[model samples]
Target: MPQPEDDPGSAPRAAGATNAGATPPDPATVEKLRSTIGSLSTATLKQLDADLPWYRGLRPDERSALGMVAQKGIASFVNWYQKPVSPEWVLSDVFGTAPTELTRSISLQKALQLIRVVVQVVEDHVPFLAPAADQAPLREAVLRYSREVAFAAADVYARAAETRGSWDTRLEALVVDAILRGESSDALRSRIAAVGWKSQARITVMVGSAPSEPNVGFLNELRRVTGRLAEDVLVGIQGERLILVLGGVRDPAKAYPRISELFGDGAVVFGPEAESLVAASSSAQAAFAGLTAARAWPGAPRPVSSEDLWPERVMSGDDTARRSLVRTIYRPLLAASNGLEQTLSAYLTLGHSLEATSRSLFVHANTVRYRLRRVCDVTGWDPLIPREAYVLQTALVVGRLSAPPAPPVAANGAPGTGNGRAARAGSIDKAPPVPLGRPSAL
Candidate 1:
């Protein structure tokens, strides 16, 4: 039903309201609206300006406008003392003052409340640009208040952005350092998961061209693919390698093709499914071992995992076979110099006789004794026993195969002096390579 507009002659309702015919605003709703304005965080309020009406956005002229408005309100209110004026005039008289008077020290909460009131006054009746009568005190008060509120809002958002940026930078540095040191894949998976990463099952490692500047969106796409392909998957970087760990895969082999396509010509090794991250860590270790093998022996069409080479590792562990290999490889080195060879052969053959080999090498009894002792110390083997001799022989052959290539022989027909090889060949009677994890210097 239509309602009649209020007659001009009728008394008006209270201020901060629409026309009398308009539905009366609920007190609760008004309070809620006011609270929302008062509670707006500086960051959130700044966001509103992106799409808010022109009058709502921050403006350089806002301070002057506030000062003028406040001066006018206070002046009009005072002037009304001489003659009758509208209720708005009375409101200005009650509240308005110079903008300069509203100290910049006001809190955001207080500023927000003041701005809402200013907006309300403009909406109710007056244009913001209305000329000030003699209300200089009111204009100054409102101008100062508006300036303080705007400054508070901006200051809050700037502080929040700075805090967030610092956090993000620290996290990036931690991740990069961990990768280079070869951190376990499962740990990385757990971290990424807490930050909304969905991939926690199947794993593959990926290395980016510019890892320091990660494209989060692209990595996120990779995470999404793993989720669809496996139950839980995670991707991370380790040094130059990108590691992906897969968990709870229903058919690991079936998913391999898709991962291969995504990580072409990259170190994309996969791990076995496991019940938990600890199990996954073990599986990742196996994958890493396999990856090490693949790198050493390339030309395999597909990526391999550590589980694939368990048989070889086991077979290579046979004690008898290893002993035989040691004997075959080092017999020649022992046979090279007659004086040295015969002494070594006799020392091993006759149970390391300082007395027997002394007579055998035709040297002074003391000299034979001294050479045999030196041989034991040099090869890390007891010349009097077979076991230590065999162990040392095997290690020498293995060291030849695995150690870095001997530094090139020098132009003077001498091995380079600074490198380990030059040092070793310089004294053939010196110590051989020690066993793994035990320093040769010892």
Candidate 2:
């Protein structure tokens, strides 16, 4: 429908109608609102103490800090309403003064509750401060500003949480590094405590190749997998290698199969379990040495024990492996009194043939077999298996080299020329033979 042209005086009225809801508050009204901010802040604090359990539970200093925040928030709101809509001013003025650790003291939900109380207090005073016709637009602005405050609160908490997570990860990596490096300082213990390490539980280290691609969730996945087995883990990914310190494991060998898939494709080795983390350095040393030497054995198990790779470690000049071999296998066999050492030496020297070894030792084949069984019972290594025989043979050579030289004696109970071959032959001949029957039970 065509309309007649209106008077030019009505043009200003038309523009005022278009901008009605968007008009800024009068100078007198803005000053009156600012005058009420201090009282409003006090009322908001009272409301928080009366209604919010978390706020009421805060200590005196924390309560004081929160009170300051409330006062600043009220003052900031007054300045915000005076200016045109600027959310950045609210952030810098209201929340910027808040201490960084405020999030640690108050949760995001509780902070939102605080914001609600502040907004409600402000809304309750709106009718008294503004004319009835102006109240609706002021209330709408308050609601909009509250939403911005809520979003800013969430953003602050999100960034704080991310920072805490990153700091915890770095501290955990340092703790694992100290453990693997064999550092048992009081500082290390304190750091372990800081990281909430389970100190009393049994701890073992697992070493393997790191994944080619970085996975930020790798540690979480490791924890998920190990947690299914009722275990806790601390992980460190150092360059091409990944290390995990597993806790609360009664049997690492049993636990390895379930968690081996977490590691990348390579030789994964589990160190022996220590009584606690302080003593875990020995285990870590063995596992790391084994991981380095595991490639030597192409058929090594995916999650092989550090002890299982002792021979390879020794070959690779691992002093711990050499000492372990000497202590665990050689020393124990030497200390057992049933001529087990001589029998083992003969068994290996005679190409692992029971008949040849028996002939060499002047004992019945059954007796030789019985001694071999005793060796197995003592050392947990069966001579029949090629791999175990190799370990035993290596142990024998290492043991002989480590022991003091034996004094020379003649065969006929007389001092003789430096040869002990006849003495060794006679000693074998003079020993009592076992009955030719089923091998004696260990």
Candidate 3:
């Protein structure tokens, strides 16, 4: 069997030659070798000088001479020797301590030059060591190094993925909050940057509400459908509102209706096109403004866009303004005396029928004529004039619609009473009890 130093299984060392057949090394010689190597300077040249004694003491040439003897089996030992000089040089030249610290310091300029060449070799060797079937010791070393590198790479990928995901989630949340709050365009822009959104991509805004949990569930279903179409849409909640961010749309008209169909009759607003993320952020705010306008106005279909409703943008901020306009244009009839107001309201309601008005109010036909004439006298309103009547009727209808609903009551004052009409009409003074009695209504 080969001695330990000559065994292929042994770690490579610079002193393999003396161990072939000579007496095993004494402890003194081993200690001296170690001390000599440890004493070398960090300077590579000084290390090379220290290596000479370590190499010559090994008697490597004598070992090579002994290798020809077939019976001695020295050839095996000779063949197993590796790095007869280089391995020791690595331990000494690259890592040894120096007695004189000044001599150990390499010129910064020279160190940099050497480092460049060394880096190039490492880069070039990476591919060679990655493959299988290299020498067992070399392969094991390479694989262990690779495992360390792979672990580092995995850690980096995990960190990046987590960071990006967290950032996007926060971004979506901010957008939704802005939409629900009906924030201003400038505020929306500020929020976008605050959430670390990409400042360069085009952005689109959507505003609507999901009244119940089911509606939110519907929104998620709808989001999945849009995702299948490959549209990048982000969903988040703000207050009671649901806001969505859409991008990469070349044409909006095509996209708008599809969303409308998904949410029939629900309020939705889309903002105008924006060139960049900042612009899109502002545009989303504009769209929310459009939603407020739609809710305030008389007529707006779902998925309303800011562009189509520019003329009436003023109404979004001032709903009372619209109501005031309707009121001002028709106040004359509204403020008329109660009798005249009743007559006018009835005439308009019964479709200009004096008979119907009389029957409806439980009055004589002639009484309605008398009341109509009084209405004309008091307010100068004439049912005969179509234009004036039209205006008066519209005002009355709008006023009633705007007003609180009246309480329901029976026509009769109470049950089992023939005096209901008399009670309602109040008692006539009947000529103040004159000496000669007068008939009622006389």
What TM-score would every model get versus the actual structure?
0.32, 0.82, 0.33
**Between candidates 1 and 2, the TM-score winner:** 2
Cα displacement (angstroms), candidate 3, residue 326, comes to 9.4
Per-residue alpha-carbon lDDT of model 2 for 6-25, expressed as tens digits? 53421112211122357887
Off by over 4 Å in 3: 1-135, 179-205, 209-234, 245-249, 260-442
lDDT ranking from best candidate downward: 2, 3, 1
Q: What ranking of all candidate models by TM-score puts the best one first?
A: 2, 3, 1
For model 3 the TM-score comes to 0.33
Error of 2 at 292 (Å): 1.6
What are the runs in model 2 whose C-alpha is more than 4 Å off? 1-21, 26-28, 227-231, 250-254, 349-370, 410-442
Tens digit per residue, CA lDDT, model 1, 69-136: 43343333223322222332232232344322333323335445545555344333222222344234
For candidate 1, the TM-score is 0.32
Q: Point out the higher-scoring one by TM-score: 2 or 3.
A: 2
Q: Write down the lDDT of every candidate, Cα atoms only.
A: 0.46, 0.80, 0.49
Which residue pairs does candidate 3 place in steric collision? none
Q: What is the lDDT of residue 77 in candidate 2?
A: 67
